[model samples]
Target: MAKDNSFDIVSKVDLQEVVNAVNQAVREIETRFDFKDSKSKISFDGKSEITLVSDDDFKLRNVVDILESKLVKRGVNLKALRYGKIEPAAGNTVRQNVTLVQGIEQDIAKKIVKAVKDSKIKVQATIQGDQIRVSGKNRDDLQNVIKLIKEMDLNIPVEFVNFRTF
Candidate 1:
């Protein structure tokens, strides 16, 4: 049997980077002239969630923008953030929750597999847990699969990992 080349497609976020981004955002808000007297706050909830509170919807949006920019600077994908609706808090403030996505969901994994199958690149893709593994008889075919996947414009961010030729 011919050796197969393979790689795993996974969607993951580094929690430490997220924490750093949140902290940077908080620091900026603290020093920014416009936010001096406002009640804007950003914090991490549990392991993979962020809670943001602000005096109003406008400030909340600004806070989100700051956090997103920081995340981008840290090389974190903005698509990994799943945000909840802005709601009124007890002190007449607005609060929002942003959930960090750490892995690909089953539907997304299936979509990845389907995309690879339809690319006509002579590769077999299978969903393994929260990721998709693509394997082919030629290393070039595997590389083509990666390129094709990048061009598919999927909603989530994907990382190519565990590339093996055997």
Candidate 2:
């Protein structure tokens, strides 16, 4: 009998890179002419949360844009950054929470599951928490699944791990 082949597909963001980007953005806000005097600031709380504060919504948006640019430069996908609703603070200030969403969202995850099923590959796909595991009897079929997935424009980064042949 042929050995079973399998691998796990996961979508995860590196929190350290996000922290570095936030730090760089804060420095830029401090030195930039328009932002320097706006009292806009950014801080990372906990391991994966970023808080942006500004006097006005416009300034807050500017800070977010800068942070997004920094994230892009660091090869971080913008989709991974989930922004909370902006609200007024105690001092009539606006603040927003930028949470790093490392897991695949439900819709995207379902789309991936459907794509894999539609590919006609002889693999069984199961949603394992935030990731997907694919298994098949033939290694060649498993490789084909990987290749096909790569060709699709999922608009998200996918990492293959936990590969094993049973």
Candidate 3:
């Protein structure tokens, strides 16, 4: 009897890394002359949201750019961020909220399953809560599925984990 080989695909972000990135961005903003006196700020809620406030839209954009660079340096995928619309804040500052993506959305998981089925690969792809499990008797087929998924432009960063060959 050939036991199945399997792997799980999930989209996740490390909140600690996000906090570090936000802290780095804040430090940089404080040192930069353009933002020295300009009310530019980045605040993280220690969970899934980061808020940016600046003197105006231009400064706000600069703050976002800095924060993005810091995040990238921390190996955090830019796709994990969902930018909110800029709006007025207290004291006439422009504020924007950036939501950190934490899991594979249902629609995206369905899309992944559909893609796997359309490929006609001899593997089973199933949505398991906020992740997807792919299993097959042949390990090569599993590898092929991984390659196929890597080729997909899913607009979110995915990681493969819990690979098991039984």
Per-residue alpha-carbon lDDT of candidate 1 for residues 1-166, written as tens digits (9 for 90 to 100): 8988888999999888888888999999999999999999999965888999999999999999999999999999998889999999978999999988877899878777888777788989988888888889999899888888888877788899999988
Model 2 lDDT, full chain set: 0.86
- Which of the predicted structures, 1 or 3, would earn the higher lDDT when compared with the native? 3
lDDT of 3 by residue, 90-160 (tens): 99899999999988999999999999999999999999999999999999999999999999998889999
At residue 13, what lDDT does model 1 achieve? 90
Q: Which stretches of candidate 1 lie over 4 Å from their true place?
A: none
Better of 1 and 2 by TM-score: 1
Colliding pairs, model 2? none
Assess candidate 1 and give its lDDT.
0.89
Give each prediction's root-mean-square deviation over alpha carbons.
Answer: 1.2, 2.4, 0.8
lDDT to native, each model: 0.89, 0.86, 0.94
Tell me the RMSD of model 3 versus the true structure. 0.8
Per-residue lDDT of candidate 2, residues 1-166 (tens digit) = 7777899988888887888888899889989999755768899874778899998998888888999999999888886777899999867789999887777667877888899899998899888888999999988888898998888887667888899987
C-alpha TM-score for every candidate: 0.95, 0.83, 0.98
The local lDDT score (0 to 100) that residue 137 gets in candidate 2 is 97
Task: Output the number of the lDDT-best candidate.
Answer: 3
Query: Model 1 residue 130 lDDT?
Result: 86
After best superposition, candidate 3 residue 14: deviation in angstroms? 1.2
